[model samples]
Target: MYPLNLPPAQILQLSSQLLCSGLALLLVGLAAAYGLEKQLNVPTLVLAHSLTLIGPSVLKIGYVLRLVAQQRLKDETCAHAIA
Candidate 1:
């Protein structure tokens, strides 16, 4: 089962990693596509398209993870205040 109780720090770390990696992938993909468009080779085209598609999805997930981490932190703070 997926762990929902990850520490906020860990979650934030994962989120940052995903965000950075996704941005890198997106940039590389766009670069490859624009830089290699004239060639139109099958492998290049596939790699570019795949990276373009996967990058945004990873970015979106990272954004969601960040939000989740923030919420968890808020909850922890509220719990502490209540106690």
Candidate 2:
């Protein structure tokens, strides 16, 4: 797990990196689909795209869950320190 203590700038950079990668993947998928339209069936193409997007969607959910868990741990630690 990545440390949430990462600097804001670093976090922003990581996020932008992920965003660009996802965009690139989408572009590549689109290009391939366009190029292979005659060879690939439309339903199969759509299904593959749908399944491929699930991976990123799950990744996003996992990231959010980690952030939430980190926040909760931080809150607990601070509370313990203040008591």
Poorest stretch of ten by lDDT in candidate 1: 1-10
Alpha-carbon RMSD to native, per candidate: 2.0, 6.2
Per-residue lDDT of candidate 2, residues 1-83 (tens digit): 44566654555556566655656665656655666667779896775576457546645744564565556568668999999
Candidate 1 — which residues are off by over 4 angstroms? 1-3
Off by over 4 Å in 2: 1-41
Per-residue CA lDDT of model 1 for 1-83, tens digit only, reads 23467898899999999999999999889888888777879887899978988999999999999988888889889999999
Q: What is the lDDT of residue 18 in candidate 2?
A: 60
Q: RMSD in Å for candidate 1, one decimal?
A: 2.0
Q: TM-score of every model? A: 0.90, 0.47
Q: How close is candidate 2 to the true structure, as a TM-score?
A: 0.47
For candidate 2, give the lDDT of residue 20: 59
Instruction: Choose the strongest candidate by TM-score.
Output: 1
